[model samples]
Target: MSRVLLLGGTGDALRIARSLRAEHVYSLAGLGRTPVDLACGVRVGGFGGAQGLVRYLADEAIALLVDATHPYAARISANARAASSDARVPYWALRRPAWEPQADDDWRFVDAWPHVVAALAPFRRPLFTLGREPLAHLDAIPAHQHWTVRCLDAHPGNERARIIDARGPFTLDGERALFDAGGYDVVVSKNSGGAATEAKLQVARERRLPVVMLRRPALPAADREFGDVAGVIDALRAQPFPIVR
Candidate 1:
């Protein structure tokens, strides 16, 4: 069994770890957040940077490297790719495909989070399902409308950033209640591309509200790309172990 380092935090990462648990593979997760009951063995905190990551890989004698991070986590992915190359470890990513918009979805796709604010025209009050980092972007765009922002932590500071403290895998009833109670005419969500946060989109669809969708950055031109967990496991199995030269 190869000792693989799994760089992960997102749902896809969790999925991949669970899938490989029975393969007799010894897996360790590299995480920014303190893992709460992770599917595999874990290590928390940054690995310095690309150089630091490479050194850690070398010291641990990691046989494989998987960058199964969030799509928005470009810095870590970049570091993972660079470190894997430097350490001569086989590298792969478990990135999920972005959600496609249906005509009935009434989505306005935007490039950046800041730009998303500008993209919004006059509508009814919006329900913002934004990430913690980009919360300020909502205030950047002109305000002909109001917004309700959701966060796991107690969102303080910005009077403009209306805060709703809650967590993920949001229930359908909860989503519907939020929309109905907030009097939201539209939904603003990141193309996070996971089941956990998807209820917001479903709520928007039910209400026939316009959704401002933030798209993902393009993956680096790696040799492979897998839109699912199964594909990721296959990649892990196919890649040969690092040569101890």
Candidate 2:
């Protein structure tokens, strides 16, 4: 049977994997402390790099490559592009639409975490939802202000920053309650987009909170890019069967 390699990270990856008719393998970088519920056979961790990924695709006879990772996961997306070209497999990127600023929103877009830090200097009692990777920058924040950081898990044991161990599809009411109760002065997050984590933005807007939004990294364009799961399904269905050489 032809196998499509579904690069899994985002919720869309799991949805696409579940929708596939052909044999497929769901691949995760294994960044999460616990495994997410996946729809098909799974592979965890990296394929080393582009070269390693190419070898895996060739060796496993991956016919189609679907990248459905977080918008900020640039390295893996680049690797997938290179590996798919080397392996002669069709590649598609499942990118969700980015959030646009509304009339009431106070958004400051920056390129990276350092820029976020520099922009954040004037704000007090800031809340960061940029996930754990960006947590390293927390040490540089002024000691006078107490910061709140939210993550999927509670592993870091960070006493310096107040940690909220929560997962999302968070609601506007929930976000408002959290912010109101925490008495946050400002908000920081990546431009991750999609519905799952967007409530914080809406709440920020309603509360007149200044949002320090990190612009997404420029990812290599795939042979095709899809905005939704149905588009991805159509793309996969259009591909030829996997070949075992």
Best by lDDT: 2
Q: How does each model score on lDDT?
A: 0.70, 0.82
> lDDT by residue for model 2 over 1-245, one digit each (tens)?
66888888777777776665435788888876424454467788889999999999988878788899989899999999999998898898988888999988899999977788799889778888988865665566587677898987775535567878888789888998998888988899988888889999988888899999899889999988988878887766666763211
- lDDT score at residue 172, model 1, on the 0-100 scale: 86
Off by over 4 Å in 1: 18-33, 36-39, 137-145, 157-160, 234-245
TM-score of 2: 0.92
Query: Model 1 lDDT vs. the true structure?
Result: 0.70
> What is the alpha-carbon lDDT for the whole of candidate 2?
0.82
Residue pairs in candidate 2 whose N, alpha carbon or C atoms collide under 3 angstroms = none
lDDT (10s digit) by residue, model 1, range 1-245? 55777777776666666655432222333422354554456666778899999998888767777777778788888888888888888787777767877667898888876566666667647677766754556556355666677866665636544778776788889888877788888787888886788888888887788888887776654446677887777766565642111
